[model samples]
Target: MAVEIDTSAFTEEAYELLSELEDSLLELEERPTDIELISRVFRAMHTIKGSGAMFGFDEVAKFTHEVETVFDMARSGTLPVTKALIDLTLAARDQIRSILDASRGGPPADQDNANRIISGLRALAPQKGGAAATETKAAAAPKADAEGPHVYRVRFEPKPEIFSSGTNPLLLLNELRDMGQCRVVAITNTLPSLEELDPERCYTHWEIFLTTTQGENAIRDVFIFVEDDCTLNVRLLTREEEQEDAEPKKLGEILLERGDINEEALGKALTPLGDRLVNAGVVSADKVRAALTEQRVVQEQKQQQTKAAEVDAVVRVPSTKLDKLVNLVGELVTVQARLNQISGRLNNQHLQLVAEEIERLTGELRDNTMSIRMLAIGSTFNKFKRLVRDLSTELGKQMELTTAGADTELDKTVIDQLNDPLVHIIRNSIDHGIEKPEVRKAIGKPLVGQIHLSAVHSGTSVLIQVKDDGKGLDAQLLRRKAVEKGLLSPDAVLTDQEAFMLIFGAGFSTAEKITNVSGRGVGMDVVRKSIESLRGTIDVQSELGKGTTITLKLPLTLAIIEGLLVGVNHDYFVLPLAAVEECVELSPKDIANSHGRRIVNVRGEIVPFIRIRERFAMDGERPIIEQIVIANVDGRRVGFGVDTVVGQHQTVIKNLGGSFQYSDEFSGATILGDGTVALLLDLARMVRYVEMQETKETGGA
Candidate 1:
């Protein structure tokens, strides 16, 4: 069977074809050697070529033919699907899209890029197999099919405002003749008299007869671009059929023939049938009622099915939309709380019930909407496997990436923001944390280096870690670098943990030489800034030559938070509940035993702690029996001493605005039900404050 191809149809159809080509190229990375994938790619190219020749996209067909030949060899099992081949085909697929894009009056295709892709395709051609001969045969088949002569009659009526629409009827008429033999005859029956004629309106139509073997569809397609607004018809007539007089069937007659509806049923349905059916006994009253009810139910079911299908077909929306929706829900929740307060005071049962119902619905909606934005971090983690493979190959090292706790889910927006920081950390681990294979082997370690990236939910926060089994950070070198960068004093007394964190200081690099991977002293500072901006914390743990683990503790979502409110100087402050470990009371005797040190003795172990009042620089004297709220920050136990612990709250975190933006101690502010704003503590910034205070005290001593 032969199909008539229209150049007008090619514009849209070619775009779809090239999009499929690009999708196939992306799929190849996952299933490079799958024969089905290779065959599907081949068939898509083949279809593009066949349809291109039938239409006028000859350049697209010619360029795709060479790429298709390379895949054909791979299909025949003569050439393997190597990474180089996949990359080459990916580049060629892009070129094919560029060529098709240009056909639609887009920017011109770059010849240099086209030549580069062509060279890549040529490199994949089989050396011994008759692939070239096979390809030549496929290219010749279309030429032979383009050889017959046929006749077509065309009728065209341009719309009354065709000239006003900026369409040139003359250009369309010329395009029709370019295909084959053509004739044109104009009909002036609708043209107005000279006094009534309007030059802006098109009043004439055309009837033309052309002889070409392109088939009826081709003739019809020539007018497809104008078919919606203009009257167009095409027919093929032979000498035998011309002897008889016949007219084409109308659209209504065709629908009737197709059994879509009957005239008798339509007439009966159009009448006032409710009272008539009851009186005629053609349908009993009960039976008629039952039928109507059944029909209504069926219609409802169909509507529900359609809605479900539409929902299923919807593409995944960006998390920003969900975030906005959640914000709206939060406002609704606040309003609902206000209504509940009013209803409680009014003692009206109906209003109370309505308020209760609204509260339940608002809560459920908030949860369901937030769940929609939640996604498994595994998708983000899987990408690191490919990264490790490529980077290890480039660095001439043997490194294996292992992941765990991938089932952990976080807000989609958080995952998107997490990708870049995670990538930088992973790169740093591979380049600097994991030693070279030779060095590892000389030290009697395994030849293969291992990097583990794992995440787990800790209360409301997700804890992720990138750990590597290689030489850990050299504290002495880091200290010297920190001193040289002026981030620390030359005579600064520091613990090993404090020294290691200096790597995150700006302008500090311990790498002896700058390499392509990550030795410019840029990535670690970015990692720190990004994590801090997300209200997250990062901690580094290392042993001289064993390994290092960098842990990141991030909130599940930045919009809403689970908080523990505490009263400091009669003002409420919100502390993330995930970070609250345990609360302990500080007595004057217990403070006296510590000798002014921040360390507190808790259950026979020394856990360093900080007082919230002191950290915030409150002026009031300390409480006699101070309550120390101990929490774990980056695996280190720290305590915040407050006056009293107010209860748990679901706080909607709002930015502190430009006025309070400079204060790192407070991440955001949340309004309590009583219209009071409670500041949310920044645990990461608090820890940094404690570290800085310790450094200053040691220097003074």
Candidate 2:
């Protein structure tokens, strides 16, 4: 039976098989002598070669044959899977991919490189097998079939474009002859006359006869590539039958003659036998399901593992889907807000009951949708291992990366934007923060440096910190650099915190020398910008000669916020509830004793304070008996005086666009139930700014 080959499908299948082979090779890197891994690699290449010839990918077949022979030597224990061999094979695998990729249009592969790789591969082949004996066996193996040796007759007719596919039929015929007792007869009955012939089109077919102990399935395997495009019939023929000049039994004929199954039932069963076999474990259940699901897919194609193909499959869906879902829930929340407003306005029993029920359901729905986009930050953090390992090796430093709270989950969007900033901080710690081994030894420190990346939930925010047990930032050097860069006045008095913040200023790197990794004077500033863009804040704390720690505090999600709404001069402003420690009622005596300075005594600690009306530039007069909202930012307590506390609200955050981009006090805007827009306060930035002002005044005194 002549089977027509589809070159495109053949190439695709070859690539997939080779990819699996490469994966196996990679896995074997750690355990080179793993017999199972070696066998798998061999099987993968064998299948590629077998199917390649069947589909007219003769170049692939010929190339892979030599590679497989080398592995065979290793399989037989005549050669070991050395590190050099693995490296060479890895290179060869990459070359194979290049050949497959270039098959469509690129020039012929570099035979010199191919020959070189093959030579390396061949170096591993056993020399114990004398050349004369090997050649004698190779020549005589095809003629030795007798007795009950399995015989298979395969007829293949490739597509008319086979010739242009860079495949020669003679190569496949020769390959089959090398396998076992084989005879190939080309059939040109369909060829056009010389006057009408089109040379580009394939006008030849082949009927192949093979006798071997190799199973009937193995013979059919030779035709796997062209099975769909051509007709194929494989059966058993005994040596006695061949000598008696009897034709090979067709599959249907054997089934009928053997009385194993009836013709009518066999016809029906053949269609579903593959599915039944797959269900019974002869084939994978996934394959059976895929075939049942996609009827148009060929049986040979479906026979391959579905999971293998799907392993790398990814589908890109539009973000509009997520946005629409979020918007609908947002609207529902607004409606619930209106209901709550109505329930409060009218104490009607029925209305209040309905409002309570709707509120419960709406809250649950919002949480569920938000949870859908939450992902653990560990995946983003794990890539640093490779980075740290490479840098430590290059710099001749011993370093270990310790991560904690890897299960800490945050909004996917937040984590996505956080990757680059985190990389910068990690690189800084590895390149500049971590001291060299010799320096550390001189300082009585351990030879190895320790870099820790940790994340944890702090109220409604996620705090990620990178700390290293190495030389910390030099505050004095930072201050000197600040003055030199004209970032600070020459005689400016500075606190430790103020000096540390200078690293975040653009072009303010303190590294004495520049290397490929750091000291470019651009990293920390970028980290600051990225964190701030997410409505987050970063703090740097370092102990000289000990280590430096950079912490980024970010919201749990960007979409909604839990805020403490406060009244400032009849205007409502919301502060993130995560930052609020407690609220206090300011007494007249307490207000009078402050002496116009924004500092309040809470317990035994003196906490800095900021008047809300002054900070937000509100116009109305201040109210008596002011309410104070105490917030903690970067381990410092700061108090904000408001007219009244309006209680907590789940506010949906809205971006304040370009107009309010520079407004450090308000992070965003949110809509109230009464259709009023309240600006959301960025408590961290507000507290920092107030503390800076306070530091300047104290320094002046």
Best model number under lDDT:
1
List the global CA lDDT of all models.
0.74, 0.73
lDDT of 1 by residue, 403-484 (tens): 8999999987789889989998899888887888889989999999999999999878889999999899888888888887
Q: All candidates' TM-scores? A: 0.62, 0.59
- Report the C-alpha lDDT of model 2 over 1-701, residue by residue, as the tens digit: 98765577667667767666665775676588775677678777778888878877787788787777666656544568887777677667767777777878876677788888877766555453543333333333222232324545555668788666566667767756645556565656567899999988887766566655445655665556655555565545343333233333344444355343455654654445655443444333433332232232222122322444465474433456876787788778877888899898998999999999999999999999899778888777766765686688788888988899999999988998999999899988988888889999998999999999999998789999999998888888988888888888887888998798888899888777888888879998999989988988888899998999999998899887688988886578998888889998777788788887667788877777788888767798777688888998767788889999999998888779898868877878888888888898877778767767877878842
Which regions of candidate 2 fall more than 4 Å away from where they truly are? Answer: 1-320, 393-396, 437-448, 603-605, 692-701
Judge candidate 2 at residue 575 and give its lDDT: 88
Best by TM-score: 1
